[model samples]
Structure formats: C-alpha cells, structure tokens
Target: MNRYMWIIVALSISPLSAIALSPEEKGLEIAKEMNRRDDGFGDFTATLEMTLKNKQGEESVRVVRNRTLEVPEDGDKSLIIFENPKVVKGTAFLSFTHKVENDDQWLFLPALKRVKRISSSNKSGSFMGSEFAYEDITSQEVEKYSYRWLRDEDYEGKPAYVVELDPVDPKSGYTRQLVWYDQKEYIPLKVDYYDRKNDLLKTLRYEGYRQYAEKHWRADRMTMINHQTGKETLLNWKEYRFKTGLSDSDFNKNSLKRAR
Candidate 1:
C-alpha cells in the first residue's frame, strides 16, 4: 500500500483509542461506589414516601418507615414498615439477593400467620398502593441489565456521561432508561425512563450530593415526574450509614416476623 493510505489508517484508530472508558463502564463504576460506603448502615434510619397516579388523575400516597442493615456486596437487607392507615405497617417485607439467581423474597403478615410467597410473576404489582412498582424498589442487580454508551455532555454546568440501559428481564416494568452520571463525583444526576410501549414515561432529577467519605456520595433528594400523568414522586434520604455488621441470619425467614 501507499504511505498516505497507512497515515490515514493510523489517524482513524487514534481517536477511538483516546477515550479509555465507555458510558456503561462509567455507570457501573458509579454504582459500585454507591454499594461500598464507609459511614452508612451503622444502624441507620430514613423516611420514604411514594406517590401513584392513574390516567383519570387520581393520586395515592404511601409512607415508608425504613431501616437498613448494610452488608456490602452481599445485599442490604431493609425492613420497610408502613405508616399509613393501610395494613402494611405491622407486616414485613424481606429480600436477599446474591450475585447469582438466588434472590429470596417474603412478606410476613399478622393475618397470614406464616410468610406468604411472592412469585416473580407478581413483581410488577404496586407496593403499598404507591406508583413505584415492587420491581422498582427491589433493585436490578448489575447482571440484569445490558448497557450502551451514548455520549458526553454538560449537565448543570458540569461534565457528564450519558448511557442507555435495557433490562435483561423481559418481565421488567420499564422498557428502557437513559442515565446521566456526573464526571467528578461519579453520581447519577438524572434518569429518563421509558414505558412498555417504548415511549418516555418519566424523568428523575437528583440534587444535593453530600460526600460522606472519599468515594461515597449521598444524593439528598430525588424527584420523579410522570410524563403522561403529570404526577410526581419524591424521595428524601433522611440518613444513610455504612459498614454495619449485618449477617446472613438477619435475612432469614424466621427473622422476618421479628422485623419490627
């Protein structure tokens, strides 16, 4: 070949080599930081609230009394106690998900006496009459989703990375989601959710990132707005702790009834 042809080939590959990380890789790096924190879960407390709306403009709100036992990488076991007039407060919700497919979930109710099984099929059901579905709260481990790097842009005057995520589970409620990660803190600043019909469903915004440790950051408030219904849900993290001595026994079935 000619010298000009070789020079052209070298220039074509140089630009691609300059960028070291992709968008999906950046998002995964941020998520790992969130999992491993230094100061959260030393017996922490938080208040969670969720709102739901229908096509007819009816809204329902649910309050959650939350306590989390942090076990880094092993999954954080949290007991969500309902505070509304509904029959959920006294009941307990327990979940333990490992790196593999051994995710165990149980619901203990005073009415049932014994813990009732929650099948994977019913994962899309509403939680305590809130807009957030059960699958939304339980979390999707990194293995459950595939990612694509979109691009880099400025968000809130800071450099940010944008990525698209598609769930591996066909039964998942979301169709797809686009996420933006702050380049400095490596925290998610915004997320765009798509519905089952492949249309934009909602937009979530994050604000007030307080650095807990060298690599830990806590977003004080997160708000989600439904594009179709014009309804909104807000989550304020009252507190978050890390490195608590939570054990495997704490996530067992017998311990669920004692979750209060």
Candidate 2:
C-alpha cells in the first residue's frame, strides 16, 4: 500500500513540475538563465570565420578571434583578435561601451604601431569579411528591447517558444527581431533580424549547443547568412569559460588603445 501511495505522489507532482510555459515566458527565462552567473560577467573565446561571396561567384575567407567580457549595468566590453594570414596576424580590435554615450572603439595596427578610433556608422558594418555585422558581436542588452509572445511550435525535434522583440531605442541597428527558444532548456534555437524598413535582412541559426555550467547552455556554433550580400559567417567556440574574475578596468577606453 505504501508503494502504491508513492506512485500516486509522483504522478501528482510531475504535471505541475513540467508545466508548459508561454513563449515570452520561455525567452525571458532563458535570457535570464544565460546571464545568471557572475552577475553577467565572464570571458569567452571563439574562432570566427567569415566567408564573403561576391556576385561573380568568388569567395574570400578571413579568420578571427573573439573575446568578450560583460559586467552588470555596464555595456559589453570586447576584444576581437585577427589570428590568421601573415599580413593581418596579431592585429587586434577592442571596444569599450559607455553608460550613456556611444561605445569607444579602436583598432591596433601591427605595422603602423598606432591605434585608430572607429567611427559609429562603421561599427554597424561587417567584422572582417563575415556576414555577422560588428554590431552583432557585442552582448545584447535585454531591456533595450521589448518582447512579446508570438507562438509555440516544434524546432529541431524539441518544443520551442517563439517570441518577437521590437527595439525601444530609435537608434538601434535593427528594427525588430524574432527569436525561437527551446522549451525544455530555454536556449535560443534561432533568431531573425528585420531592418528598419520592416524587411527580413538576415537569418541567424544556432547549433552545437553544449553546457557551459550548471543551468547555463552555450551555443558552440553559429552561422549567420546575409541574404542581401550573399555572405556568411561561421562562429566556433574554441574556449568559453565563465566567472573569470574580470574587472571593469580591463574593459576601459585605455584598454582599447592598447588592445593588441
């Protein structure tokens, strides 16, 4: 009789424990989950490969190294190192974000021994030759965009929640974004970007997910395809370590000038 009672208790709690969540609920939950550690401060290392195809059916490849560190209430601090080929080897670019003003960016030239400031408009442009624009490399600020539940669906054989986001800031690079999140894990499966004219500009697909830590799932591989430019960028996470004890001073404007 006690065994039978235990079975009933398990059945009662199962349904309540795995309640199906709404789309917005899933997206927000996953966003919050990814940032749950170190107060959103950590270090990530990845190999970024950019493939640019021209209308003439020619393609060029550029390999890069990407590192990012984020701190709460502060914008994303990042460094992108160019590691391939003889000419651009050891070249590094850094960006320091501001609380109110625009981000300060700089590029260190190995031959020139000088760091040049990056203009705002160029930041929205491509990084190296990849389809992933420079704007996409920085960490996304959740509050800058408002979210709404779109629908529930199945993605890659897993339950998914679809949500749409409208950029609250007028100066945002993109007007709207649609995200698909895994229902079970709360990880983003796919995201769509729409331009200011409300047209689909690019489609980004996330794959090769691996657990970075407890309750934290990181996408190890991402492919970004540019429909307009016929180019693509593939990002492979070589090393993604969390809670590295990175300080704010490591991400200041002075660091940008000394990037390489």
Residues 1-260, candidate 1: write the lDDT tens digits: 89999998787665334446566665554455434433344444566666566666676767666666655565556666666557556777777654435456777886666787666455557666554566666644566667777888999899987878787767877888888878666677998889899899888898888865345666777777778877777676665554445556766777777776
Tens-place lDDT digits, model 2, residues 1-260: 69999998777655234456565664555555544432433665557665566656676767777667765576777778787765888788888764445677878887877778877545457667667775676666566567777888998888987888876656766888888878777768898988878888888999998876454577778888777776666676666676666566666546644654
Which candidate has the highest TM-score of all?
2
Clashing pairs in 2: none
List runs of model 1 lying over 4 Å from the truth.
1-45, 51-61, 69-75, 100-102, 213-215
Question: What is the Å distance of residue 231 in model 1 from its true position?
Answer: 2.4
**Per-residue error (Å), model 2, residue 81:** 1.2
Worst 10-residue lDDT window, candidate 1:
34-43
